[model samples]
Target: MLYLCIVNQTASQNAEEFGFHAGDIVQQWLWDDDVDDSICTKIEDLTGEDLVDEDYGTAVDGVVIWWRDGDDEDTLADTIVDATTMLEDNGPVWVLAPKPGRPGAASSSTVQSAAKTAGMNAATPLTVSKDWNGIRLRAFGKGR
Candidate 1:
């Protein structure tokens, strides 16, 4: 899949592209200083709820994961599998990683490989932010 799929898009546009819905209990994984606040805030605006991180104790309707190049495929694959434990079936799992030229950036192929290893289907990379790219993962042969 191509990188930077969305260009000159508003923060709200980026959030909408994330596929979130009203009343969706979204969990944000691996929150860090690098995560884009504009996008995150827009997500909240759309969902009308604050995003729950891994520290939260509850099931989620969807998940947003921030990943980096240093985060190995195996560990990430495991994280993807574990993320399913608290997610509703067919819920979306979004993996956001640094784009090329950014520090600690991971390639789209790596994310795709991890998703496959975790038994999920990886969608094309989306330009979520200036420094990051994202992909949506779903149960194998499920969310086409």
Candidate 2:
């Protein structure tokens, strides 16, 4: 008798570097004009998750929200609330904004304040792409 085994080895080894895991549902919100396809592809490939572009109001594992510095704080807070509301329990929200030297770049402190106003805790920043930086935030308790 002959024995045969099947194995899958194409999985990315750096998925965790981007804070992603297999089967995670990532929703991307575009508030800026620049979009990097390479970065998007890498995210999907590494995480093995579906990168959705629409806001369906359903629970998601994570959210990638891109915005500019000029965006109004009130509006940004509102948007963050809405976005975090749709996330699953313990799901993270990544707020991506322009880098410091880029046009319409928002300071990290400003982003942190906005997240706080939205009832979310802003974590340290990360590089999302060549032109954008991201800050991870988590929603407050259910009541908030």
Q: lDDT per residue, candidate 1, 42-81, as tens digits?
A: 7888889989988778888889989999887899999898
3-105, model 2: which lDDT tens digit per residue?
Answer: 2221212222243445667778878876444765655677787668768874566678877787788888777788888777777866767888888899878
TM-scores of all predicted structures: 0.87, 0.78
What is the C-alpha local distance difference test score of candidate 2?
A: 0.72
Poorest stretch of ten by lDDT in candidate 1: 1-10
The TM-score that candidate 2 achieves is 0.78
Q: What TM-score does candidate 1 get on C-alpha atoms?
A: 0.87
